[model samples]
Target chain A: MDSMLSTPRAPRIAEQAAQWLEVLQRGGAEERKAFAVWLTESRRHVEEFLFMTAVDRVLEDVDPQQRIDVEHLLTQGAGKVVPLPAERAAAVSAGVDRVEPAGMRRRSVMALTALAAGCAAVAVAAWGLLAGTGWEDYSTVAGEQRTVELEDGSLVYINTLSQLQVRFSETGRDLRLLQGEAMFSVERDPLRPFRVDTGSAVIQAVGTRFNVQRRSRQTTVSVLEGAVRISTEAQTQEEGELVAGPQQSVPDSGMLQAGEEASIVVNGRITRRPIAEVARVEAWRERRLMFRADTLQDIAESFNRYNRSPRIRIEGEQIAARRFTGVFDANDPESLVAFLGAYADLAVDESGDELVVRMK
Target chain B: MQTESSKQTDGLAGTALEKYRKDLHRFLVRRLQHAEDAADLAQEVYLRLLRVENSEWVRKPQAYLYGVAAHVVFEYRMRTEKEPVTFDSEVMEQLAENPAGVQPDELGDRLGLERQLERLLGTLPPTHLAVLLLHKRDGLSYEEVARKLQLSVHTVQKYIFQAKARIRMEWQRQEAQ
Candidate 1:
């Protein structure tokens, strides 16, 4: 095998496979016909195509959190301000471009002002002081995770495909989890409460660590450290300033202590339960997914969040209902694929656009 | 155990097999080295092709047939061979690394591969790296990437193809080592 790979024909075959892959992804009917003819020309062509496919799968599986910031690298390479698109311009100036030297600090501050104006739809009057301040927006793309430290010494562990807006005013520390999941470790401040609004629910905590995951129709809150009071009513602007007061127990409000979890539905229904193991729920911070007899459907959904290609698709209801218990690296779907391949009752079809699982 | 419903579901694959059975058998006989295994390998390839959700999407049936045949042959060698294949040494190393003899977790291997790709990407020219990342990471089209980078669409495609070729070569070099 080593001898075969060392031959000059190997690199040529690899280059042909790469070109074929590109054509298959972006080309029209004529190009595909050409590819099919090329694929059938030799056995070496077939082997190289499979090998390149594996390499492309590995590229797709790379953890988005570890991806190098392309725009930042390009800017550094150019050593001059390159014109950025509008939405990206805001993120660049507010987040990554802040690390520039003193010479570019003034320009970044000006960019921050522009960002503040752009966010005026959601920002209040107090947010006008965002220029050169701690107010900012943080987000992680698909399969990406990040931990950010706020000005008040609080930590936010943002999960994949999440968006968060932080507005730290003199009166209160307000955070809005616009989408996806995030864990907030709040700093103790009796005067200002840390509140996270998930569109459907508003959770208020004081000097505690809690996780809030905003799904399509429901927001799930799991308290790991201290008690958090959740209000399922419509969010008011002044809600962020309400600290630990005597009226904490409102009619539409419920308190979840450590080792407790709650699902607040869209229509203001809160179902609270005791968490068997809080650590399992928080395992995502360590990039591990721990499942206990989870259905194949749910497992596939979780894995799909991190992988872009060869998506796991359960074809039959019986196969989808099968129970799987294991600990898998969140970014590695090959492990799951191997497990499925070993199961006697299941058949995995990996030839199509998705990895389809069916009952044998 | 083949029921009436199973037969109906296998209609498209049965047609494909009828058309390409001779070609697949001949190809397998050459690759398997054991001519006796050729017939069984063709049957395995047929079964796999039957599993495809939609055979109609396969524009070129003969090429698709050979593709499935190649996959079956590869798996046959993997199952029958005693000595570990050197090309898959990375996976073999992963299996051997676990002290508890548990199933090999792909996390460590994936991380190592990611780092290797990162280093290889760093060595690429700026234009090649940018074009590759913009298309792959940012999900931009070839036209959009060309527009953003002020390069022609054909150049963008060439850069991407070359970048992947370089990565493939790097992986081969490591495996050779």
Candidate 2:
């Protein structure tokens, strides 16, 4: 009787929401009127509709580059049985062979094998494998963050409004931090050194954890663990042209160890210093921003990356230059506005889309 | 008859504005995150409602009023934000409170949500997955997807609807755990 009964109430509501979603997408005055009636029938209808809409929003983030073998899937009976495409299978096999027989590679292989047993698991494994073979672009929109795990066991923590490109070859693992910030935890492969290119600077690491941020015409690299060899793009290019043998030393290049930071301008100027607060440099990974004596203008710029509405705008130079020291949630710009509003000399206007700050 | 319907529409808008103004303002404030902007937009919703041509056809003015409110908010964000708008913090908080909705930990992280989507999409039946990918990921219309898949447009719509409902139910089941 339970099996023969009608569908559960929750699923029935979900089905109704799905139908409404289709109707809403059509965008007619008549359909909208109907949707309004359906939506107001019960509070549960409204909640279910919002929930489904949220799920649809999440669907937009699915990688557009993902390629599915529709023909193969359809021929295989279109159920829980998904066969790996020919090219993806080749890629997986090629990866298994080229990867060194180290503990890390073995662990990665074991994980892949375990996932490969499930019908859908093969698709995920194939996606991960294919990402390693060629240049793939990974990016986060405004107010979003992403973590990408490369085939070589490295992990990239991409900050909001950032773009990164990754390419792995037999001899080297290369990454380009095109814009914004990224923290890389590189897996060790002495044969294929990890190198990140930021247009202005090229950071070469054998095995290290580092963060690179590209802002305007400047690129800042901070080492969290191990060491990295940093060189201007010009110097590396010149070294490649002149040096015939394995170049042991690169001219105008510097080595930075843990706790060291380097800033390279577009004009090949390099500045090195010890990081004042390593935790602050790493705070974005945890969705919190830590600022120490940072100007309001800079803080506003940072918060703007995570929020689109209620933008923070500094009205006066005095207010823009006011230094603040505190930790704030990256997603909550209102908290920052409230904090500034508490000050005696600062005025915060929350009446508009822009939270304007000025001298009282 | 036309004039009488227009007058009825005006009356409907007037009464609905008085009844739902505060509720509309609160709703806008939750989504727009600014009380002043919400207040301004609440007025705009009523103004737009008064402009509707088919006022007599609206049997439930309250539903239509809230519907117009949502449309106004959507248009305002699309004009100003210039980026894809996700669930507002209020909606997200409400969803987090519901047991059948996505967990807070999964909702807060974009990467986590993405990976969960990838895994969830993998488990879908092949035809459902193909239809979903073609429609959502590729941005193909139902007719275009039908032509490409050699299925009727109605079948395509049914597949998409079924896929979405399946994913939503599965997501709820996962979150309930």
Which candidate ranks first by DockQ, i.e. highest?
2
Chain A TM-score for model 1, please?
0.59
What TM-score does candidate 1 get on C-alpha atoms?
0.42
TM-score of each: 0.42, 0.42
What DockQ does every candidate get? Answer: 0.08, 0.11
| True-structure lDDT of candidate 1 | 0.62
Clashes of 1: 0
* Candidate 2 lDDT tens digits, A1-360: 122111224467766777775554434467667766665465446545544555665565453223354445566543433333553455456664332222222233233333323333333443455444556899999889997767665778999999998877544577888799999977655445578888787887644678999999799999876667777743334312211111244565777776899999999788999998877788898889888999999999999998888788889887788899989999999889889978988888776689888888
Please give the lDDT score at residue B53 for candidate 2: 67
Off by over 4 Å in 1: A1-135, A234-249, B1-177
Model 1 per-residue lDDT tens digits across residues B11-106: 344333332332233333233222224335544554555565653425653446544654455456666786554445354233223212121223
Best by TM-score: 2
At residue A218, candidate 2 shows an lDDT of 98
